[model samples]
Target: MTTASWLAIAMATIVSAALAQEGQTQSEEIEELEEIVVSASRIELKASEVGSAVTVITAEEIERRGDRYVSDILRDVPGLAVNRTGSFGAFTQIRIRGAEANQTLVVIDGVEVNNPAAGSEFDFGSLLVDNIERIEVLRGSQSALWGSDAIGGVINIITKKGQKGFRGFASASAGSFATHDLNAGFSGGGERYRFAFDASRFSTNGISHADEDDGNPENDGHTISQGNVSFGVTPIENLDIDFTGRYTRSFLETDGSIFNVSSLTDLDNDATVYQRYGRANVAYDLFGGAWSHRASVAVSDVDSKNRSNNATSFTSEGDKLKLDYETTYRFETESIPDAEHAATLLLEHEKDTIQTSSMANEVDIKTNSIAGEYNLSLFDDLHLSLSGRFDDSDNFEDEMTYRVTAAYNLRETGTRFHSSYGTGVKNPSLTELFGFTGTFVGNPDLEPEKSKSWDFGVEQGFFEDRLVVDLTYFNSRVTNLITGSGNTAVNLSGTSPAQGIEVSADAEVLDNLNLIASYTYTNAETADGTEQVRRPRHIASLNVNYRFLEDRANVNLGIDYNGDQKDTRFSPTFARSIVGLDSYTLVNVNATYDIHENVQLFARGENLLNEDYEEVFGYGTPGVSGFAGVRVDF
Candidate 1:
C-alpha cells in the first residue's frame, strides 16, 4: 500500500481506540495550572498561575518536529521574529517583542551564552538539538531578575537529566544539498549518582549566504559538531548537586562584505567558531522542607576566526564567569488561613572579558546584582507576585528594576486573567563602549537604555479543557535608543516604542487530531516615526498533528506566514538604500512510524511550497527539501 493509505488506516485505528476512552477522559479534565514551569518565575510554578507571557517547547515536541536548528522551532512561537541569512549554519537572529537582537538574554543550563565581543548577542545558529529537555521563551522585560540584556525577554534552555534506568538512542538522517545528521546519547542513574552524555554532528553543502543575483554564484557550505555531558548526585534526601558541560564547533564558508557589511556580497571568506559552556549547581532543603537554598557557578567561552583569500585574518574571543545564590522561604499566616506566602532572595555576580586580534588590550566588565521576590497565593485561586533587582556595573550607570504581576483563576468559567508591569535597563555592550577602530568607533559616554513595559492577557479554556484560547496586549517604551550612523555609535534623544497583540489557540478537535494557531501584530518604530528594519508587522502560524496506530505513528504539518518588511541593502556604488522585502509563506511536514518496539522510521519535508523569500536582503534561502531517517532506542 502507498504511504498515504497506510497512514489513513493507522489513523483510523487510533481514532477508534481514542473514541473508546473519550467519555472517561473528557470527564476527568485536568486543570491547566498543573503544568509545571520554571523560567517564568525562576522557580517552579504552574503555567496558569504565572502572569507572564511564556511558551514552552518540550523535548517531545522537539523530537516530533525533527528540527535541525533551534531557530526552526522558535519560528512558530508568538511575539517573536526569527530571521536567517540563508541555509544551514547561517547567522540567525531572534527579536522578541520587536526588541533588538542584543537585548534578549539567552541562558543554557543556567549560564548566559551571549558573546561579550559581539554586542552581547547570542547567535541562535550555534545551538543545536542534541540533549535538550525543554525550552522556555519568556516574553517582556525580565531585567528585574536576569540583569542586563534582558530588556526584551529570556530564552532558557534546560538540558536532559539522567533517568533511573540505563537508556540510549541513536539516529541518523541524510537529505538534499549533501546534508547529513548523526546523533547518539545515553543516560543512566543510580540511587545516589546519575550521568548523561550526548553528541551530534551536522553538515551541509549549503547555499550561498548571499543571493546569486547579487553576483554571488559560488556555493557556501557549513559543518558543525556538538557534545554535551551532565552529572548529578544526591548525597542525602533533600540535597542535590549537578554539573553540566557543552561544546560546539562550527566552520562555514561565507560571502565577502559589501561596504564592510558581512553576509551581503560574495567575497569567498571562511569563518570558524567555537563555543564552550559549563555550570555547577547545588540545592538544599532545610527546616523540614519549608526553606530551600540553591547556589550555582557557571562559565561560558566563545572564539571565532575569519580569514579571506586576500591574506587577511581576524580573531575574536569572549569569556564570562557567573556566581549566583538564592534562598526561598514559605510561611502561612492565621489572618489568611487558606493563603501561603513565599519570599525569595537572590544574589549574583558576573565578570566578562573580550579580546580581538586588532585590539591592543582585552576589555573586562564586572556586574553584581541583588534581587528579591514575593509571591502570595490566596484560596488557591488568586496569585500576586512582586520582584525587584538592583544592579551595579562598571561600564554604565547603576540601575534598579522591578516587576509586579497578578493572576486570578475563575474555576467555574475555566478562565484566567493576568496582568504585569515591569521596568528594564540595558548596559552598553563592550563593543559599543570600547570597540576597535576601522569598523565602527565606540562612544565611551553612551548612557544605558531604560524601558517600561506592561502586558495584560486572558486565557479561556473550554470543551472539557480540550480547547484553549489566549490573547495578550503588550506595550513598551525605551529611551536612550542606541544605533549606528555612518561608523559612529550614538544614543538617540528620542525613544523607541513597540506595541503588539498576540492571539493563539490550541484545540484537540478530534480524538486523534490536534490543532495550534497563532497570530501576532507588532508596531515597532523610532520615536520620530521611523519604521525599524526587518521588523514584520504581521506574522501567523498554523500547525496540525495527527496520531494513529495506537500512538505508534504520527504526522505533523505546519505553515508559517511572514509579513512584508523593510530592509537595508549596501553596495559600493549605491552606498546604502532602503528596500521593501516581499512577504512569503512556508509549509513543512514530518512523519514517524514505529517498525519495532525499539526502532522507528521518520521522514521530513521542508519548504514544501518552495516559495522564494528573503529575511535579509541579498541573502539566499532554502528551497523545497526532503530527508528520511531511522532511530533506535534501547
Candidate 2:
C-alpha cells in the first residue's frame, strides 16, 4: 500500500476512537494538559494552545536516560535525525524534516550560538546536558519569529534557575573506554535576588574516528571543561534584571585524510575549540501587568584550532552580537467575554564577524529586522496567532516572511486539531560566500535559499487521559538550495520537495509503568527525483519507564531503529558515488536507586545488544558499554 493509504487508515481509526469517547469526563487523578511552552510564541502558552509541533524534554527525563550529550536525548523526538561521526565527542549534526543541518537555529538562554565561520551550523558534539532545566524543540519554518537560520526549526535550551532556598548538587561518574565525568552546581534565591553557578569536566579515551575494523588501531581521546553562571535581581516594583554567562573548552583527537581522497584512515590529528556566550536582559511592566517591555543583548564567540603532526595547520574565530527590544500589550474586551488577546512588537539587530588563517581580512555581516505578532484565544477553545517579519541584510536581498497558526479543542471529546503555515529564508553563510581554503571555492553571486512549509495534526486522548496519541503531516518546498558543485558553492535552479509523517504516543500502562513511542516516515528528494543523502525513509523509537521498590528505585529501557539511507562516498578509484547504509537497532537500559533522602546511585548500559552500526559512513560506533555514577544533593 502507499503512504497515503496508511495515513488515511490511521486518521480514520483515531477519529473513530475519539467519537466513541465523546462526552466522557476525564478522571480527576489523570494528568492534565497544562504544560507551559515558551518557544512556540513570544509569550508563554499552554502546549494545547500552540498550533505548531513541539516536544519538551525535562530534566527528569534526562536524568532517567543517563545521556551525557544533549543530542542523544533528542533522538527520540519525531521528525528529527541525529548523526554522530564517531563515538562520544565526535562531530554531530541534526536534521529536522529532512532540512539541511545549517537551517536549524539553536538558542542557548536567548543567545544564538551558531558558528558563523562554519556555514552557520551549530555542532552538538560539545553540548553537554549539564544544568539544563528543560529543552523545547519547536519544529517547522520559524523565520517569521526568529529571523535567519530558522528555516528548519528552533531549539531553546533553558538552564536551571535559583529557587527560594539554597541548594546544591555534586556528581561523579566513571564508565567504559577510560571515561570520567564530574560535575557540581549550587543555586540560591530570595525575594529580590537570585544566583546560580555550575562547573563540569568530562574526558574519555574514545575509539578511533575511522572504523577499527578497517585496520585503524590508534585511539582518539576527547576532553571538555565547562562553566555556567546566572544572576537575577528585582531592584524595584515591576522591574527586573537578569544575566547569564557560559564557557566551554574542549580538545578532540581527529583523523587525517588519506591521499586527499578519504578521511577513513587513522592519522595523528587534533583540534581545540573554545566557546563563550553571555546574555543580559531588562524588563518592566506597566498598568498592572497589562503592558510589558523588555530589552536584551547577547553575544557569542567561538575559536577553533586544528593541528596535524603536532603543528597548528588551521585556525578560525567567529563572534556574533545581537540586540533586541520588544513590547507586548494584553487586554480583554467586554464584547468578547472571556476572550484573551495580546499584541507584540519586536526590533532586533545582529552582527557577525569571522576571521580565519586562510583569509587576509576579517569578514562581517549585519542585519536589522522588525517583527510583529498577534494572539487570540476565544473562550479558551479556539486559539489563533499571526506573525510577520521584515529583514534587511548587508549581504543579501531584503526579505519578508509570515506565519499563521490555529488550534481548536473539543474538550467534550478529548480531541485537538492544530495547523500551521509559514515561509522562511536563509542567507548565504560566510563560508559559502567567501569559501574556505582547500575545501570550497568562493561564490559571491549565490542567492539566498527560500522555502514554504505547512503542517496539520490531530491529538486524541483516551482512557481518562491515560493514553495520548498525536499524528501530523508536514510538507515543504525549497528553491535555490545551496549545494557544492565541483568544490564551488552554488545555488540550484530547481526546487527541492520534502514531505513526512510523524506519529507519537504516550501511555500510562500501569500505576508504575509508562511507555512512549514515535515513528516517522520521510520522502525527501532533490530536483532530479533522487533521494536526498543522509535522510532515512523510516525511523522509530520506543521507551519504557518503571518505578518500583516503594518509588525509590527506577528503571528505563529504550530502543531505537534507523532505516536504510544513502550517503556519498569518495574513493581513489571513483570520484564520488552514492552508497547505501544498512539499517540498525540499538537497545539501552538505565536504572537508579535512592540510597538516602539526599543521595542516589545510578548505572546505565549503552548498545546493550552490541549491534554493529554506523551513523556516518567510515565512522566507528561504540560497542556495549556500562557506566555507574553517584549523585548527592544538599
Best by lDDT: 2
Model 2 over residues 220-311: C-alpha lDDT tens digits?
A: 99999999999999999999999999999999998855775564889889999999999999999999989999999999999999999999
- lDDT of each structure? 0.86, 0.90
The TM-score of predicted model 1 comes to: 0.94
State every prediction's TM-score relative to the real structure: 0.94, 0.95
Least well predicted 10-residue stretch by lDDT in candidate 1: 1-10
- Mark the regions of model 1 whose C-alpha exceeds 4 Å error after superposition: 1-33, 258-263, 310-312, 573-575
lDDT value, candidate 1, whole model: 0.86
Worst 10 residues of 2 by lDDT: 2-11
Writing each residue's lDDT as its tens digit, candidate 1 over 101-220 gives: 999999998889999988889999767877789999989998997888989999999999897889999999999889999999999999999999999998989888888766677788
- CA shift of 558, model 2, Å: 0.9
Q: What TM-score does prediction 2 earn?
A: 0.95
